[model samples]
Target: MNTPAPGPGTLAEQILRGVGGAENVESLTHCATRLRFQLHDGEKVDQAALDALDGVMGTVPQSGDRFQIVIGGAVANVHSKIMNLPSMSGGGTSRPQSDADVKAAVRARGRGRFAWLDNFFEYLSDSFRPLMGVLLGASLIIAIASVLDALGVVDFRAEDKSATWVFVDAMWRSVLYFLPIMVAYNAAKKLKIDPWVGAAVMAAVMTPNFTGMLAKDSGIPGITCTTNATLGTQECVARVFGLPMQLNDYGGQVFVPLLMVAVLALVYKGLQRVFPENVQLVFVPFFSMLIMIPVTAFLIGPLGIWAGNGLGEGMSWLNGNAPIVFAIVIPLLYPFLVPLGLHWPLNALMLQNISTLGYDFIQGPMGAWNFACFGATAGVLLLSIRHREKEMRQTATGALAAGLFGGISEPSLYGIHLRFKRIYPRMLVGCLVGGVIVGVLGGVNTEAFAFTSLLTIPVFSPTGVYVIAITAAFVTSMALVYFSDYRTPEERAQANAERDAAEAAEAAGAVGAAEAAARGEAAVTGDRETVAADDRELVAVGAAGAVAPAAAAAGADAAPTAGSAGEGFALAAPVAGRVIGLGEVEDPVFSSRALGEGVGIEPADGHVVAPADGELVTVADTGHAFGIRTADGIEVLIHVGIDTVQMRGEGFDVRVEAGRKVSAGDLLVEVDLDAVRAAGHPTVTLMTVLNTADVASVEPHAGQDVAAGAPVVTVRR
Candidate 1:
């Protein structure tokens, strides 16, 4: 029975069911290509069913009670729909609401003192993951401004500018300048609190009245200001009531908000319990903000700044003293870090560097990793084009565009790199080479937190060095992917065989449709079964006429060659059995000619022999299948039984090895048909001409019993 494919919503519903419905799910999140789940009971998940869903690419079970469903690029939409499902409305209620419950549910993978470190990284990852699209948009705007600056059209860095240019600057600066407020909101949301309250608290310190203290004439009493000789920036301090407080601009402060939100959540939740349920709505926000605002400005704000500066300075010191190690390590680490969402802390540090030190060094070496990722995708695209792999071609094209133009690596990393095991190692080599080059050239630096894309190349200093390094990285990975290929040799052959079979079926179908039209039947809307019957009859008549020519070519030598007389060759019976048509075979791989034109034989005896004179190419370790190549370029595969690989050499004994010459009637293997049947497998041995597509025609002889020496298939090349 044929089941219709499901839409995204239906597929999402199926995924929910496969994961043991909404009750088993404790929390859900999604990245570029995976729907990450924190399940209450991982054992309850029906992994096999989930992997077989219509839109699902694969499934991954992590060390914890965590599972990931790979949905390629449409993962975000799927995640949204899954969260909004009616069945998921009360999903959270099934599990406890405490922090311990949440931790116990998601923290199965880690234990001991270091476990908190994992949770901390996860908190940081969730806070910034949702901002990726906006971050990329802002970076592109910076790229455009840099391009204008390069062409002498505008001085993007100048404080004095026209209204139009100032408005243009605001396009990207809005995201970076008010970044602290954004981080606060996201951090609060991750902790299951009111996000707006966190945003408001952060915004209070950034207000115009609070910032006015920096001005000497307009500021209130007890305010002092000075200019730093080293950084060439203004610094201010204000004494409110009795305590002195350091005044900072607070623009683009990431760590401050992250720290403030943690405190706010505790205060806000405590207020919720103290106030009556009726007044909780109004009193919670009122009391929480009244207390936390002062606390953030005086305590959390300065502490976060100190912590961020310390981390940035440590990295800066490393870069200054040991530039080579720092350069190489940044690129090497990113490939591993990006996929797990663990790189957000480093990103926050980049923003901190720009706000404090006036420039960043990490983006320069990091560009090598980004381009190496894109280069690997380019390799996949090249190979897909050469092999006519349409699905892979489209995937590679989309991923490459996102990587090069938008400076997004998630699309390529999840859609292509993570899926292919061979790509990461080759890509790392590119990363290493590019890093070495950048380090030797004294490294590159940027004054803005620009994304590492082709358009943003001008943002980095010494554009020549940056370009050369990235170009070498891109070319190296691309060549490796193209030359070595992403799939193994056996996998490639199986894929090729499937493609050949599809093309052959399509050609045969078209011929059948044409013949039906010639017989005055309806061409476009005719009964397909009638056309198929006619095609089979034509094949049978053609087979009868080709036998005489095949025998003439054989010249009584048993194995026939096209050059001797006929158009191609003939394959003799490999074992004594009833001759069955290819259509009668139970396995679709043989019945549909997916592995090329073949015949099935229900063996009457245990003995098997060579069908034609050829050299052995493959002898299965399980004693099931053998591949032989003849002199006229005819390759044939003799398979002993259906689904017999599971027998593991139990019911059969091999008498030959690969790369050995053998004539027709050579002993190959001895099989026990009763033993194969008792093991719940078919004892039908199949003989297929593997290179049938390269020949003129292949015809199967069936419906009657035949001895081991009798002819059963004729091939014309």
Candidate 2:
């Protein structure tokens, strides 16, 4: 019986074992082909074992205990499997000690050497990353409302709008107006405090009681208000308990919550230390609220408002005095900034600009970067379809949809552009072109904070110029990526070879199965003897001038008799290499004989020739493997280069098509060993017998180098 293929969960389990179990893994994330792991101790990992796993394409170890396991098209499944592992439950909550150790190690590694910088960015990322889904949802809502406004269905910005339009506006406003609470919750969670308490503190300031102070009939005698000359909006001060407190709208104010939560965590933690364990829950939260709420309203909130306004004013000055530079810099800077989470501060500035200036300019130029990103993904999608690259096609399709419709760039950025380095420079050029166009046309501005998507075109002033600029950016990037390609020439060639080999293998398998059915039918009809005779004759003809006389005689005489006691066959070496026992192969599938008994070969030459006269049964698209079936019922597999499927078929030349008859020693493929090695894969070629269970015994010869036509394995009854 054949060993069943490994299940996805089984593969994940094997990978976890290979990577020193869950304890060694600090955290894991995947992008396309590789599982990126930040490990607690990279030295503890068994690299060789990881590389040998059947589903894993290869292993790469980076600096600082970072490891990557390449899984090809099935990366998403593997990633999901790993995340769902029992040890990975609740986002590392189940294994607190292990998680704590990993985090400490990471901090210790960076301690005292700008480590705070890393922690600061991590804090920012964790705070905003969780809110991305809702943010996109709100942006798309704005896009829809803008679309209706553009068509004159209703005025989206009017204060006295239709009730229906007003309800639609509230749908998106629900997220933005409460954004501070959301940010507070996330920030507090990151700092290991009660998230609800942090949200409660931010919410207290936004309550109706605070806003009631703005009304002229307010009962509080100490309340005073003044109108601002710059914005023409009323600013109010409320005297509470003999102290003056500035009352400002807290909606959509990210800085206040982010700053407030940091202070809250310190107070909360200090209170926890003071209270006994039994009363900690009630007393700690109570003390935290008593301390933080007052501090936030009296100090941090006003300071945060000032900081945001100052930054917004500085950016506005740059935009006015140097419009062209501002426009160009915004688009170009965004590509790098967004990936690092540094862009959140700038995002906060955009909201501030809309509130104070009655319009925002940053998003107009930022559209160029977003469109350029989507365009590059589109180019990859087109290439995937053209080349029959199923995995890439799926990835690019989903990424493009998320970008174009939702104004979300994360999917495309992490899934594609980052994987292939060539895409960035080309995408940047598109950003530049779009920015220049906007600047030359006196720039684009939007009255409302809208996502820069096709649906939100109405939000921008001078819609025509915005449309032209974005179109140019999209077209330019798409054309560049399509023509030049995101992948290097070697990568492209390898991918093409893999596709061809897969098609050939599929075609060959169909033919082989049909032939096998016919032979089985002949045996049922008592024509076994004639069939056996024909098999010998066919083998002799195909192997003529290829095998030694003794080998040919053996094939003719040892042909399986009708209702034979056992099945047996021999495999000739397909390539000139130093032969090693199957047990010595790195890959577990072949080493365990899961695919059948095989011999590993360290190639001395690139040429791969047929080992026996037979019909080609399978051809791998990556130009890395081949399968053949002889008339005597012997099945053979010839694989070139270990983990080479990850290379897609680069540096391999296939000389013959699958399903074709070939004599022993026929040229099958030529591989470039140096190229394989350069691409970070092994050059060990393998030849295995797929039907080992049907055979009585398979004896493989080792301990010496073998020529292409050499009989390295013998199967017998």
Error of 2 at 376 (Å): 7.4
- The CA lDDT of each predicted structure is 0.73, 0.72
Clashing pairs in 1: 568-717
Q: For this target, which candidate reaches the highest TM-score against the unseen true structure?
A: 2
lDDT for position 16 in model 2: 79
RMSD of each: 15.5, 15.2
Off by over 4 Å in 1: 1-92, 95-113, 151-154, 158-162, 215-219, 266-284, 306-717
* Model 1 lDDT per residue over 1-717, tens place: 122223255887888888877877888977555688888777777764554455665565544577667676798999988888998886433455588867876777575367776567566666775665565566556656766676678876677999999998789789867877887898999998999999999999999998777787864889888864323345678997688887877876767788899999999999988999899889999988999999988888877655544444556677878998888887887887665334554666676678888888899999999998889889999998987665578768876876787677765675667666678889998899889989999898898776688878988988999999999999999999899988778767655543433333333333333433433432333422232333222322222112122212222213323453256466899999898876778865456554456578999997999999999877765577787889877878888887665555677888999889999999999998889999999999988775554566677777879999798888865
The most accurate candidate by lDDT is 1
